[model samples]
Target chain A: MTDTPSQLPAHDEASIRVDLQLVADQIKADSRVLDVGCGDGMLLAHLRDTKHVDGRGLELSMARVSSAVREGLAVIQGDLEADLKHYPADAFDYVILSQTLQATHNPKEVLEGLLRLGTHAVVSFPNFGHWKVRLALLLTGRMPSTPTLPESWYDTENIHLCTIKDFLSLVDELGVTIEAGFALDGNGQKRSYKATGWLANLFSEQALFVLRH
Target chain B: MSVLDTSSDNALAPRLTLEGPLVLQSGVSLSPVTIAYQTYGTLNAEKSNAILVCHALTGDQYVAGAHPVSGRDGWWHHVVGPGKVIDTDRYFVIGTNVLGGCMGSTGPKEINPETERPYGLLFPVITIRDMVQAQARLLDQLGIEKLFCVTGGSMGALQTLEWAHRFPERVTAAVPIAGSYRHSAQNIAFDEVGRQAIMADPEWRQGNYLEEGTVPTRGLAVARMAAHITYLSEPALQRKFGRRLQDRENLTYGFDADFQVESYLRHQGSTFVDRFDANSYLYISRAMDYFDLAEENGGNLADAFKDTPVRFCLISISSDWLFPTSESRAIVHALNANAAKVSFVEVESDKGHDAFLLDEPEFHDTLKGFLDGAARTVGLDDGAQGESA
Candidate 1:
C-alpha cells in the first residue's frame, strides 16, 4: 500500500500530544476518519503514517489549513460549527475533535453533529474544574488561569469550557454511550481515570472521550 | 493596433494543421483545423510522463518561457518551470491554445478555408468539449495515448473535468483548480454583459471589424475591464488600491480615472485589447457559459463520472465568488456519490479566482503532492530533480 517511500514515514508517535496518540489508538486500521478543527493535520498525518487510515481534515484557520494541505493532507478550510451538517451520517468511521470542543459556540450541538457524521467520535478538551483552577479561583476571586487554560478571560476562545464530570454527564444526558475516556496532565502525559468520577474533574488537566450514539 | 501575423513561420509555439473535417459539438464541421501548442521537457521512451495543461480564457499556449506576442513571462511560468510544482524538468508538459482561441489557433480571427477571409461570426460557436476533443487530436498527433495528468484552472478546469469525464481511460489523474462543474447563472450573466459590451460597440462591425481594418478596442477594453474585476476579490482590491488616488493627492470630481483602481482597470482593459481578439472573446465566453456537466448527463452530476477510473484533485479558492467553494463542494459530493477516487482542497486566498494563476505556496504544494502520488501510482520512476535550465 505504501508505494511512495518518501511520503510514508515510519511511525514516530512522539511528536503529538499523548491524548491525541490515545485517540489515534482508538481508531481501527484503514478506517476513514474526519478530524474537525484539525490544526496543521498532525493527528491525521500520524494516523496515515501508522494506521494507513484515509483521513480528511476540516480546519477553521486558513493558515493552518494551508499548512496542512502543503503537507499533502486532504484538508478543507471551514468552520466546524457550520460545516459539520454537510457530512452524511456515518460518512466516516471516526470523527475526532481535539482541544477545540470548548471553543465552539454550541459544544452540545457540535457534539451531536459529530456523532451524526461518524459512527464513533473522539473528543478532547481542557478540563476547567481541576483542583488548581478551583483553588486559584477561590483564593484570587477571579477566573482561574492554568497551563492548560492559559488564556486571559477577555480574549480566551474557550467559551463553553467544561469539567470532565460535566462532559460525562452531558454525554449521559444526550443518551450517547461512552466507549472510553482518558485524562492528561499539564505536560500532555496521559493519566488513567474512571469513566464516571469526581477524581478526574479534580486532578485531570484535560479529558478525552470516545462516544457512540 | 498590432495585426495578427497569419504566417506560421514566425509563430513562437509549434503549430499543427490537422487534415479532414473536424466535427464540433455545435454540429458544425471545420476542415483543416489548426492547433497552436507549446511543449516543455522531453517525452520519455514509455510516453507515460505526458501531462496536458489546459489554459484558462485569454491564456495562450505559452505555458512556460516568454510569450512572443506579449514579450512577457508565461502566465503559469511560476508553477510550471523546472523543479516547480508541475516540474517541466521531469514531465513532458503540453499546453494548447483552445479551439476558439486567438493565439495562432483557428478561431473567429482565423481565415476561412473556402472564403479566404477571417471566419468572424461565421465561425461556429464552440463548447468546452470541442476544446478537449481538439486537444485529444493534438495528443494523438503527438503519440501520447494516455496522459499522466490532465490539469487546468477556471475555463481550463472545465476542460480538465471534461477530459476526466469524456476520456477517463486516457487520463490517469485530474486537477481542476478554482473551477466549477458548470457555469452558474450569475457567471453567465457576467459573460453576457461582456458580450453585450462588445456587440454594442459600433467599431465591432457585426464581428466584421477585421474586414474593415479596424478593431473594437473600446468595447473590448470595457469588456476586459468588467471581466477583470470578477477575477479579484473586494479584499484584494482594497488591499491593493484602497481608495488611493492614481498619481495624485486628491480625487477628481469628474470621472477621469480618479482612483488607482480606476487607472488599474483602464490599464488592464487597454492592454488586453492589444493582444486578444474581440471575436475570440465572444466565442470563448459563450463556451464557458454553455458548460454544464450535469445538463449533459441526465441532470445528474454523479452520472458524469459513474464507475470512472481517474484520480481527482479538485481545488477551490476561499474568496472566489465567481466559482465559490460551494461549487467545488458540489463536485466533491458528486465524485463521492460516484465512488470515484477524489481529494479536495479549498485553499484560503483573498486573491479570488485568480489564485490558481498566482504564486500560492499551498496551491503549488497540493498540485505537487497530487502529481507525485499519481506518478507513483502510474509506476513512473522519479528522476533526478533539479532547477530548470
Candidate 2:
C-alpha cells in the first residue's frame, strides 16, 4: 500500500560489502544481534532477510537512523561511546562494529562495552600498516593515505587508526579469545597471509575478527 | 498558514458514560465520566487494528473529515484518509476529545450531577495520566482488548507516553511526535501568561462566565494570539509575513495593526475565542505542566519503561523550540537504557511544533514505515484490511 520508494535502499545478500559479509558469515543464524554503527542497516537487513536474525541498530546520524527505521529496521539514534553502557549484559548473541571503531573517541572502552553486552563480538577496521601507507609515510615524510583510508589526516575521522598487529595486541591485552580472523586486500578479497602474521599487517588493507569473552 | 482554531461545533458523535467514579491524580474523585469519540474505517474481528489518535491541546475528535464546528478539514486529514499514510482502508482510527476537553467531553463546560450546574472551576483538576485513564475506560466499554498503536503530538504526545508507561500491555506500539517526557520551565511560564490573560478578563467572572451570561472574549483572544507565536519559528514567520505592512503602503503612524503579523495574530486570537472555552485551556495546559515521566516512575525515566513490551518510535521537528529534538534524544537514551526496541527521527523542518499537523512528507513517510514494520512484527496480515465503514 505504500506509494513512495523507501528512503533506505533494500540490501541484498550479494550487495553487502565484503567486510560486512565476512562479519555476517561468523554470526549464527537467527541469533540476537546489535549493530553498533549500522550505517543505513545494510548488514542488519541482510541478516534479517537471509538468516531471520532479530537485529537492532545504534547509529549516530539522524539521517541514517531515519533511513534505517524507514527500511523497517529498529535503529536508535545514538553514539557508540555514550549509548553502549545502556544495554544489559548478554543482551545479544553478537554485537557488530564495522569500520567505525577508529572513528570513536575511545575504541578500547567501546570494544569492552561490546564484549560485555553480547556473547560474541564481530569487528572490522581498515589496516594502517599496509605497504602503501608505509611508502607514503616513509618516502614522502607525510601522513599516509590509501584507497581504503582516503581522507587526509587533517580532515580524517580516524583518530585512532590501528594496524592489524596493534589490534591483535589490544585483543591480547583485553584477554578475550579470538574465534576467527580474516585479512582482506584492497579489492575486498581475503588474502592468503595469516591474520596474526606480520605479513598480513604489511600487505592487507583491512582486518575482520570474531572475538568472545 | 491558517490561524489556530480550537473550536468545535459539537457535531454528532458517539458518547460513552462510565458507571463508576474515576479517581484523579490530584486525589479527587469524579463520577459518571463521559468520553466523546469518533471512529473512522472499521474494526477487525480480532480488534487488533485499532489505533488511538490523541489530539493536541485544542484539537477535537474529528480526525480525517470536515470539522463539525469550524467547517474546516480535520487537523490530520492529509495523513489519515482512505489511501493516506495512516490509511483508513487498512486500520481502524479512533479519536477522542480528551477528558478535560470542551468538545462534548466531560470538562468545565459539562454539568456536574452533584450540583446540576456547569462544573466551571469546580471541575476536578486532571493530569495527563487521568486523560489516558479515561481513554482506556472508553476502550474497555468498546471491547477493544489491545490497540495496534497509540499516537499524538504535543499535549497528545504527553497522553501517548502516559499510555505506554501506564498500560504497556495494552499498546503494541507508541509514537509520540514533537513531544517531551515532561514540560519545561519555559513552557510552564508561557502557560502561566495565557492563564493570567484569561483570568484578567472581568467578563470571565472567575471561571463562571457561562453562568454570568458573559465570555472572556478579549482575554482569551489575547492569550491565543500570544501562544500562537511560539508555535512557529522566526524564519517561518519571516518567510510568511515579515515586517511588511498589512494591506497598506506604509506605517499608519498609529497603534493600528500596520504590520501584517499583528493583523494575523489579531485574527487568530479573535477566531480562537469563538469556539474555545477559556477554562479548558487552563486545565489542559496545567495537565501538560504536571507531566514528568521520570518523577512518576520513582525518579528514573528508564524505570518507567523497564521490561515493557511496547515498541516506540519518537519523532521531533528540527526547529521546534517548544519541544526540541534534544528532548526526544533524551527519551531515546532512556529507552536504550532499558534495551527497549525504539526508533527515533528528527525530521528536518523549519515549520516548528505544528509540523506534525502539517503536510511534512518526511514525517508522514517515516511514520508509515515504522507502522508498516511494526505491523509485520505483530503478525498483522495485509489481508486484515477491515471493511471501511
Candidate 3:
C-alpha cells in the first residue's frame, strides 16, 4: 500500500505509478513541466529526479500537497478552475493533466488554460463509455459502478465523464491537434485505442491523449 | 581597511545605532538613534561564527544577559544557556534591539535631531528588510565575512527571512521558525487595528504627547492585549487557564480581571508598556507588513533563491495558528522550486509559535539534526556536539 515507512500510502486502486517511463519519454529533458492532479507529484518528480526537469503541480487535497511537499516537490494548493490563471502563458513545455480532466468543473476551459500555459498538453482519463460501465448502466441502471469508478453516484466527484470517442470529438471540435493516443485495458496496460472502434469506446478502460493547442 | 580590533569599536562603549540616513516607509529619515544590545561568546579566527539571535515581540537584546534598560530576565533563557541550542560558549550570539524598537533602538522615545524633541509619530516607519540592511552594515563594519546562522521566531523569524533573501550569499544558513514570506492580510489587519488604537488615544497628542507626560497607555494596552491573543492557540490558552476565575469569586459584575485570562492579558499589556516603545511597536509591525519576499522576485518567491547557495531549515510548530505550518510549507515549496538544499520539520508542539524559545526536546532534536547535517555539508569544524543536547 505504501512505498516507504514514512510515506502516505495510496488509499485506493488509483495512485502513483512507475509507468512514468512513457510520460518522461515524450518531453525534452530540460523543459519546464506542470502536472495537474499530480498525486504525490510522481511523474513530475521522476522527471525532476532523473531528467533535470523543473516541475510545478496543482492538487486540491491538503494531505496530498503535504505529502508531495515533504518529498521536496513544488506543489501548490489549488483547484484547477481557480488557480490555472496564476501560471503565465507558455510557462511550461508540457502541461500534463493525467487522471484529472473528468473531475474538473469545466474540462474544456481547463484544457484551454493548460494549452495557453504550455505548448503540448497531455490528458488521461478513465473512458466512461467502456463496455463494463455501459453494460452496468444497461443492465443494473444504478449510475454504473466499477473498480475504476469506485465511489457511489453520491460521493463521486467525477462529473462530465466521457468516452474515448467523445473526447476525440472534443479535441476535433475544440481545434486541438492530437499528437498521439494510447489506450489501456482492464489490467492497466497500454494498447492501441483504435482497435474494434466500437468496442474501443465501450471497453477500453482508459485513454491517454497527447494534443497541441 | 586594516583589521582593526572590533573590540576597539566595542570598547568605544558600543554606540549601537549611529542612526544614519534611516529612511522611513513614508519617505522621511530619522537620525541620532539609540540601540539596545548585548553580545555573547567570542569572535573566532575567520570571524565567521557571528550568529545574530533576533527576538520576537517583547524581546530585548539581553539574549544571555540581564536587560540593562528594562531589567527583565533574558527572554530566551532556555536556548541561550551555556549548553543550549544557541550555546553562547562557542557561537558569538549578538542580539540587538530592532530599529524602531523600544528599550534602546531609536523609537518614539528618541529625540528628533531637527526639532530637538522626541520624534513620536514623526518617527518614520521601518521595515524588516530595512532592519536586515542595517544589520548587514553592522556586520560589515565588524569585519565579519558571513554569518554562521541567523535565528529567530515570530517577528524575529520575519527578520531572519529578510536576511536570507536580502543577503543570500552572506548568510550561510537561516532558521526562520514560524514566519511567513508575507504577512497574512489577517495579521496586517490586526496590526492596523493596534496602530489605530495608539492613535485614537486621547493623550496621543498627534505623537507629541510625551511633552505632557501623556502616554497612550490604555489604547496601547488594548492593542497589546488584542495582539496577545493571536500569539497563542485556543488550546494553549484553554489548557492553561480554562475559565478559571482570578483572585475573587464568580461574578464581580464590574470591568475587572474577574477571570484568569483577563488578568493574564492585562499583565502582558501592562508589562509590555514598561519596557516596550509603543511607537516602535507600530514601526516594527509595519515592517513585517511590508515584507513580501515574492514581490521583490517579480511575484515568484521561488525565483528569489534561484542563484543562492544558502541552505535553510524552516521549523514551524503545528499548534502555532499565527504563522501555522502552511506558511513554513510555502517557504519549503519555494526553496524546492529552485532545487536548493533545504529541510523542513513542523515540530509537533502545543506551545504555540513560542516553541522556538521553550525547552522542547523535539525542537532541539530537529535543530540538532539540521545543524549537524548542514555543518557536515559545509565542512564546518565540529567538535563533539558542543554541550547542547
Candidate 4:
C-alpha cells in the first residue's frame, strides 16, 4: 500500500520534462511497460496520460519511488541485481532500461532479465567509445568524466562501463534478436541509419538498442 | 472526508473513533486511542474488497481520503485512487491507523475508566506481530476471509512480513517496502534517541503528565525533528534546505535557526506535535525497537518463511539508513533460500527512508508490473470478482 506525495527534490522533476515526450513515443500505446531505473516517474506519467499502456517501474531510491507513486504509477522499491526473479516470464510487451544499465553491478543479467520480462527490451546507455570520452581516456589515462559520467572514478556509477561493440557482443552471445539500434549525437538526436561505420562508431555520444529473445 | 452514510442503520460497519481498548502482547490492554482510517470504493457481493494497508511509523491511514486533521492528501492516494496502482475503481481499499498510531487511532488518549484518566504509562508494550493480530481481528469483524495483498513499509513492512508468516494462506501477495525482519542496531539506536528525547523533556513527569495539563511537546518535537532527519538523505536535505539561511540573508549570530536546515526541522517538529500524542510515540517506537522476526522463530530468518506460501515483492531503498538495501537483500536472500516466490528491487536514490513516499517512476512501473503479473499468475482475473481493490 503506497501512494504518491510531493516530498522529493524538485530538481528531479525538472530534468524529466525534456525527455517526457520522446519517452512516451518509445513505448507502444497498448503495450505493457516495465521501466527499470525509472527516476521521478516523468516518463510513466506521460505514458499513463497519453497512451493506455500499463507501466511499472523499479527504482533504488525510496524518495523517487515515492514521487512516482504520488503521480499514480506502480513502482517497487528495489535493487535490480537481486529482484528480477520475482517477476513471471513474458509479463509485458516492452521492458525499458534506459540510462541506468551502466551503473549496475551486472548489466548483462539485468538486460537478460528485461528480455525475459518483455517480448522486446529497450536498452540505452552512454557510449564510452565516443570520441571525447576516448580522447580523455587516451590523454589522461584515467576514467573520463563526461556529462554522462559526471562524477569522479572512485564515486562514479559507471561500474560496468563498456562500448557499443561490447554491448553488441553481449546481445549476440545471449542470442537475443536485434530488432533495432539507434546512434545519437550529444544533443540527443538520432543519427542516420547508414552512419554505423567508423565515423559513427567513434563520434556518437549515445547508443540505443532494441532486443528480443 | 468519506460518505459515512449516517442514515443507514448499519451498526456492523467499523466505527471511526479515538477511544478503545487495544489488546497487547501479554494479554494486557491499552486504552484511549485514535484511528484515522479510510475506506475506498465498494465491497462487492461476496464482501471481499477489504484490503487492509499498514503504514510505516510516521504514516497515518490517510490512504485515499483526506485526513481529518492534517489537511493534506492521503499518504497513498496515488497508489489507491481511481485508475491508480491499487485502483479503487475496481476494488475497495481499507487502511486503518494501526493500534498505536498517534493519528485517529487509539493510543494514550482514552480516559482509564479505572482512574477516570488517560492510561499513560499503564499501556502495555506490543510488537509488529501483535499489531498483525489486532488487524486480523479487525478483518474478521469486517467479514474479510482473505486479503488480496498485505502491504506496508518500514514498521508497516514488518507487519506485512508477519502477516504472511502468521496467516500464510490468508494473504494472496505480500509487499513489504524498505523493511527488515529485525530492527538493526543502527535503527534501534535512532528509535532510542527519539524515546530518550521524549522522556528527557521537563514536562514528561515519569510518564504521568496527564493531570498537570502538561504535554511532553518539546521532547516529542525534538524526537520528531531528529527522526525527520533520518527519514531523508544528506543529499536530499542538502538539495532542499542546504546550509542557506532561512528567511534572512546572513547568520543571526544568536542561537536562533540561523540556517535553513534548522528552520526546516523546526517546522517539521511544530507540525508533528499538532497531530501526534507524545505517549503514543514512545509506545509505538518501543514496540518497533523490540521487533526481531527471526528471534521469534529460532535464529534463522529463512526458517520463518519455510512453511509459508506467500508471493513477495520486497522493496528497499539505496540511501535509507533505517532499512538499507543490505537489509532488503537479506530478506530476499532468505526467501530465495526458502525458495519463496519473491522479487526484490533496490531503487537507487539519495532520498533515504522517505523514498517509499516519493515518486520514483521506475518504482511505479516495477510495482505495476509485479502486481499485474502476480494477479494473472494468482488467478485474480478468474472467479475472484472482489479479491483486490
Q: What is the C-alpha lDDT of each candidate?
A: 0.84, 0.86, 0.73, 0.72
> Mind giving the per-residue lDDT tens digits that candidate 1 earns over B199-244?
9989999999999988899999999999999999999999999999
> Each candidate's TM vs. the true structure?
0.83, 0.94, 0.68, 0.64
Query: Mind giving the per-residue lDDT tens digits that candidate 4 earns over A138-183?
Result: 9999889886556788877678878888888888999988877777
All-Cα superposition RMSD per candidate: 5.4, 4.1, 7.8, 11.1
TM-score of 2: 0.94
- Looking at model 2, the pairs that clash are B9-B69
| Predicted structure 2: lDDT | 0.86
Candidate 3's C-alpha runs over 4 A off are A1-16, A19-21, A192-203, B1-96, B103-129, B139-220, B230-242, B285-389
DockQ of each: 0.22, 0.66, 0.05, 0.06
Give Cα distance to truth, residue B125, candidate 2, Å: 0.2
- Runs in model 1 deviating more than 4 A are A1-14, A137-141, A173-177, A191-198, B7-13, B16-23, B29-32, B113-117, B165-173, B211-214, B232-270, B294-355, B359-381, B384-389
Over B1-389, each residue of candidate 3 has an lDDT whose tens digit, in order, gives: 11211121342134466536656545666566556566787766666667888878667677865655455568887777566766666677888877776655666667777887777777777788767766776666667779888988888888888888878888887888888888999889989998888889897677766666777777788889888888878888999999999988777999988999999999988776665656777777888888888887899898877756777778788899889988987887777555455555677778787777778876776665555445544555454224311
TM-score of 4: 0.64
- Top candidate on DockQ is 2
Question: Per-prediction interface RMSD?
Answer: 3.2, 1.2, 6.7, 7.9
TM-score of chain A of 4: 0.87
Residue-wise lDDT of candidate 3 within A1-213, one digit each (tens)? 011111212334553442354456677898888887776667767787678887777777655655565555555555678766655677778998877788888888988888988999988787898889989999997899887777788877788789998898888888989887777676656766555556677667777878888
Ranking by TM-score: 2, 1, 3, 4
Residue B99's C-alpha lDDT in candidate 3?
74
Better of 2 and 4 by TM-score: 2
Which candidate leads the pack in lDDT?
2
